[model samples]
Target: AAALEAYDGHERVWCGRDEERGLVALVGIHNTALGPALGGTRVWPHESFEAGMTDVLRLSRGMTYKAAVAGLPFGGGKAVIIADPKKDKTEALLEAYAEMLVALDGQYYTGEDVGLTLADADFIRERAPNISGTSKGGSGNPSPVTAEGVFLGLKAALAHKSGSDRLAGVLVAVQGLGSVGWSLCEKLHAEGAELVVADIDTDAVDRAANTFGARMADAGDILFVEADILAPCALGGLFSSDTIPQLKAGIIAGAANNQLARHEDARLLMERGILYAPDYVINAGGLMNVAAELAPGGYNREATMRKVTEIPRTLTAIFQKADAEKRPTNEVASDIAMARIADKRS
Candidate 1:
């Protein structure tokens, strides 16, 4: 009932329990006016059932806007299995989760997200056919595409701030060495950007340093580091009342979803002269990649990349509108996404 109160016009929400496998899952279909609702499956250890539901609700809504702004013929939906991936993930649990998705029919489709991977997607596909980002489907991993979009979005933010989009010689503080972060670091390094990388995972951090020559920073200090851009490629809510005042970076952009702890943080960053690339808009590359598989003539890598290339243009448009209206970029982005959803409803 509390979850329903927080629905935000969600089309449907389902909660399932698999006692046999000790699995609990929630699926939220935020919208489907454009087409079927599509998002990713996230498996994580949630403190409570409500927390897991909230995650699905929030992420599913983000997917709606992400698909709308990215011009995909899909709505937004998300699934979450409440368990620690390291210790709780078993083949039986994954298969049970897949069965839950199947029960929903074709209304929702899923791919990979945090705590889930392509291999997991493959496992889910055995029980559910409406899955994307499978190795068999030729989509491969979505991280590289996601990172590519973030790289371009960051460039657009840089152009908005300094009148030059060149990344060479620019200092970047990347606060996550995950797949997306690592790929983003590679792109930044290729463009000669000075990198300071950090992650809770020591191996990931070490790999970034060894592979890309990124200087290592402790996770606690990465947010406050004095750099031209702060790339949050990890968890959300890094920008808050306490951290906003401490941010020394001129621009905030990365692959992480929900970077702001609260909506008002957008205004705080704007007042501080920090340009932010709205998370969903900048991180739509994976969606773009998978949406290609649904293309009428089948997936084409070149065509899919062409769509991914439009991300910078989208960010530039948001920045332009924000400037014209004297509003935070986040607000502008929300307006754009909401307007599209409204249009479809109308």
Candidate 2:
């Protein structure tokens, strides 16, 4: 009940524990008005159960808005496994988590998120059928598709901020070099953008520097780098009152979820003249790809790509609406998403 207090308007939240197998997980189903909840399973080394709960709640709610805004026939849901994927992930642990998905009985369909790979999705698929992003029959790794969406959305932000959207000579500071971030860098580099990158993985950062001629910055300093754009492809809650005042980028657009620590952070960005592409609106490509697997005719890469291409259009509309209303982009995007969800419910 105490945990429920934190969930507020969520539809359902499942907590699973298996001490013998060293399994602890939380799955939050935020809404299902559009369809069954479809989101990814994120495995992270959370500090405590309460921390994991907070993450799951916020991520699940974001998933709901993501689906609604992306115009996908799905609702929002997310799962979090409380452990380090490197040291604690095991076959037994995955098997126990699979059982929890089984118990969900189709209310939620999950794929891979941070700290998870396509191989991990395959392992989970062996025990549970309610999973996407599997190598065999699912959409495979969604990083590239996700990167494509972010790239397109970033262009929209650039076009809205300035009259031109060309990436040539634009300096972009990317804050992470994971699969999606690396893929995004490839796209940005191909478009002639100058890259300033940072990552905890030295090898990944080195590769970016060598391949894209990127200048490497410390992970902590990447956020404050004096660049035209800041792409935060890492974790969430990076933008708050304190950090917003220090931002040097004119635009903030990335694949990270929940970039703002609070709702008011959007207003802060607005006041500071930073154009923010709402994380969920810009990062729905992965969800769209995985949702393709659930289509009656099965996954179609071409069709999915067509849908992903519309991300820029969606962002452009949001930008225009925000400008006309003199409101923050995040708030405008959220209102549009909620209106869509409400229309469906009505």
Candidate 3:
């Protein structure tokens, strides 16, 4: 990082090509001093070039700290293939995408992300060498490990804020019940937390209600629910000015990244006594999990868990620095990460 003075140039290489399935966009090689750049390939519906660029760059930068904070040797990088996964998936399109990744010569490793799946990764892996996250035996989804990180992060945030690790009697409202959110809901339920579950998917809601016995609510109503913790495990920007006033939660910790609508959103939360676990820092478990697998065989799971759990530690340190220095925590954290990059570059 710029402050740590640990690495060299953070040169970003890219490949964008259009075929039958819209665009195959690839951004590669963030920093190699720690090692090659390994990250997931996310396919999403993007309306503009800016959307794709923002996602890849931010996700790449996140990978850096995700690996750094998780103590892995690899640096961070991510690829975004911009298109509607629902409308434009085809064998030919994926094959062309794989050909592009294969051209990278092991410089970039691709896996699964929001709009992508293991099957897609496997398709890409056939043509691209060095890509991973397709399990050898193919046992389960990565959402659980992702959920694990979020759960641990919530525990850390809970302990940091309330001085307790237990979630019993703690009221939690979870947004979305997708793979990761559903997994997180189970964890919260197991911890004895009172749960309010919401999802756009009726099937997912019904399943949670039947299996986990979670109370269901209208999806839009979840953000405004009165609760102890509001986990935005769905999409980003659920914490903007319009929704902040309606929030009754004391804590904002969940799997969603980029939850802030703008820089001022943090101040809003702080004013409301809602300690948000800086979206990227708290939900970094999936990144850490993949990075752990890429490390040498002796990768410590407990150490990895400790690393993810330390997110609150990093966050609290940032908040304390902000308070003493009279700056925003976002400013402080960005300054720290960029300083690490600058130091390393110099």
Candidate 4:
């Protein structure tokens, strides 16, 4: 499978299928030099098993780097369940999937990802202890945590570009009105940043417009909208070859993983004068939040939030390194993360 082709020193890959549950799940552990693999579970209507594995491979690898960059005491891994969350999700199916995760014996810790929610995580946690992000004694919701990190990274980007971190009067066009996007909009709105938001869900769009006073833009137009910052809180591969040239934002930073469709897209962003905040570097808040649950004493909300504040420093360092090296920010970020992983391995 093409997904299984991403074995660039990956630790392990496990494939599971259940005829009774009518489920196909793929789990990939990118690395565990730091600790046991920890990541979220994603459920999507993938076109084929290979496609789902491909997503898992890429996402798991991203998690490895994300955890490494965030300096967490965990490695990176991810799982994908082939099903449409809207229609195929059921208690029995989730429990079955949880059983699969439990079978890994804590090697893979899963929470929630796209098409999956904290509530769904609760379901999995109910079935097994190999899960996190439960409503009780766990990271309640990662969206807000992710939004906080993105906000701080955005400030860092603004400071680098304009010598000011203030968002007041800054225009930010946010794509996606999901949990993370909505929370990000709230943070930006509170700081007096003018918001232009887009989402395929009309209710989400209307809610943002009414609650945050954000202007509405069609999902197709959000990337091209004139703005100082473009926050992509939705899916990945948005800044691909076709869309990179259309991005008008001075700085590109958001919660999306692997925002570049291809690695070279980062260079294109640099060539276009768009300051790109390395996605994993800036969006490690959610990972940091869940990883805190495994700390010696327990999960400390204050400590977790405080640790999130360190994201800007990391972003600043990456920006400086990239600028000095005349390389893409993503490349610098990958190098930094890989070096950390390598250090642990050594």
Candidate 5:
């Protein structure tokens, strides 16, 4: 019931199922004040429809704030399919999900997310004609760009906390060695940051150790490792009351969406003197990159990156405001986004 009650004034919500094809998904459009909904589709093995519903609602809302904060001319939306991506994903199932997108009549555009890939985007685009992030005519992959944004945001966080954005000698504990996380580690390593990395995939961790000369931490211990920064490139909801007390890192910056388990966790982190870069704000480079496909002329990497570079400026402003008001960075960032959306609506 609490999951069903997790509504946050979403503009539209749709749940579709094709039992024969083993497809079950939920799409939540949180706002369209600026433009049509643009977000990626996540294929996760949620325990139930309610869990998927909760994830979709929260993720879609975060997308809205992400786009608004990034000054994108698109609204926020998200989709989640209730199945293990590795085991349950199929062309037929993706086609069925695309049909659901077609039914929405272009109000929502889908791309790639947690469990999906560029190939999956291409398949969905062929059937739905409203998808981005495909390898052919859209942004090929957004992970690298997203990592760049986080890299810049982390530098900004460093500057805000220590007065210099230099990464040399800084110890960053990166959790998750996925595409985005791996790319981020590369950037940080190039900047001379010492890395302590972890991932459930031992292979990834071992690779990082070899390539970046990173120290390896067990997946569960990475969060509490004594490092200058903790980058949670894995799943969301990692910063909660239970875990905040154990965080040894002074700064939290990462590409994961919904990092805070609850709104109050921001304050908890603040209380512990952890400077948190809002998850959506820092992870928006992928959305910005993919949404460029909808631009008048088409996707332009130069223009997209030009915009992505502004992520740090935005974070700096939010950090200054948070410091002035003694408020959580997430709260301040959300207010700024909400204000932008309200102004657009009016």
Candidate 6:
């Protein structure tokens, strides 16, 4: 505890919990350079306490740098709740977690991520004033914005990695069909890209396969599907050495954050001749647009388009730097984001 000071440095950090309602929350605060920490709350059925801790801490830190790199006014922070979305969501549980968050004052602000919804967030906000990403009478769902960013990044990856700016016949294997994945698939399908989709939710899998004539795979088989691109719209760290050995894809670009099993895996992907689009970099588009909505007159669609499309440019630059210096792309990108974060000493 004495040694863990920086948010990114702590692999296991404590995020207060609500025992009465059996809700476990892990909050990761990456930086406060711009202002108070801002992040989203992701609820999932986690297997262990350690997994929850590792995810929250890493994601929170990623948010910090993501915001910094995107030039947003918010700091990085993330919250994770341990529970199966299908089995364990209760109003009492959410309110209890909200109470825990309210106790933090304004040091951390939460929006919605992954398993949590805007409505769920609003339920939490009933008790905790710190949550963001609600309907608020007009914001609509965040999935479209997030998917838009991912689409732009995918275009970038295809151009940078596949040596073709067109995805007309590219084989793209998508691992999830949630709001983000579904919209992303739509964009890819409309672009004439062939798609193979998978998801734990049978309804979602069936919808995508039926609507778009996509080939479907078993949930676990999503990883090994032979394709040109693997889009992980589901979760993080699916790119472990074990899984890496199974993939025959040329590139990986998705909306999920923190996709590496470990940070070093970024280089491992490179070593295997797979061009990796840094998850945080590509996924920053939605958050950037969200932050814009908080500004005066909301967001400017044209301006946001120009800014969001820059994700690939940034990734391309990082790839070039890594190639020139013969270093890992992750290291160069981290250094860039870290330099902008506030330096703190304990």
Candidate 2 Cα misplacement greater than 4 A, ranges: 1-6
Q: How high is the CA lDDT of each candidate model?
A: 0.89, 0.93, 0.72, 0.88, 0.93, 0.79
Error of 5 at 136 (Å): 0.7
Report how far residue 319 has shifted in candidate 6, in Å.
2.7
Task: Compute the lDDT of residue 314 as modeled in candidate 2.
Answer: 96
lDDT of 6 by residue, 142-248 (tens): 67878888887788778876577698888999988987899999999998999999998899988998888899988899878899999999988798878887888
lDDT of 2 by residue, 96-195 (tens): 9999999888989999899878999999999999999889978899989999999999999999999899999999999999988999999999999999
The candidate with the higher TM-score, 1 or 5, is 5
How far residue 92's Cα lies from its native spot in candidate 2, in Å, is 1.1
Model 6 C-alpha lDDT versus the unseen true structure: 0.79
Stretches of candidate 1 off by over 4 Å are 1-6
Residue 301 in candidate 3, Cα distance off native in Å: 5.2
Clashes in each model (backbone N, CA, C under 3 Å)? 0, 0, 12, 0, 0, 1
Highest lDDT among the candidates is held by which one? 2
Query: What lDDT tens digits, residue by residue, belong to model 5 across residues 1-346?
Result: 7465568899889999999999999999999998899998999999988899999999999899999999889999999999999999988899899999999999998888899988888888888888988898788889999999999999999999999999999999999999899999999999999999999999999999999999999998999999999999988979888999999999999999999888778999998899999999999999999889888999999999999899999999999999999999999999989999999988
Taking all chains together, the TM-score of candidate 6 against the true structure is 0.90
Report the C-alpha displacement of residue 193, candidate 3, in angstroms. 1.0
Worst 10 residues of 1 by lDDT: 1-10
For model 4, the stretches where C-alpha displacement exceeds 4 angstroms are 1-7
lDDT of 3 by residue, 267-288 (tens): 8877777777776666666666
**Cα deviation of 203, candidate 1, in Å:** 1.1
Candidate 4 lDDT tens digits, 1-346: 5664555678888988887887788999988988899998888989988888778888898998899888898998999999998999888788789889888998899887888898898878878998877887787878789899999999999999999999999999999888788889989999999999999889999999899888999998999999999999888878887998888899998998778877778999999989999888888998888888877888899999999999999999999999999999999988988899788878
The count of residue-pair clashes in candidate 6 stands at 1
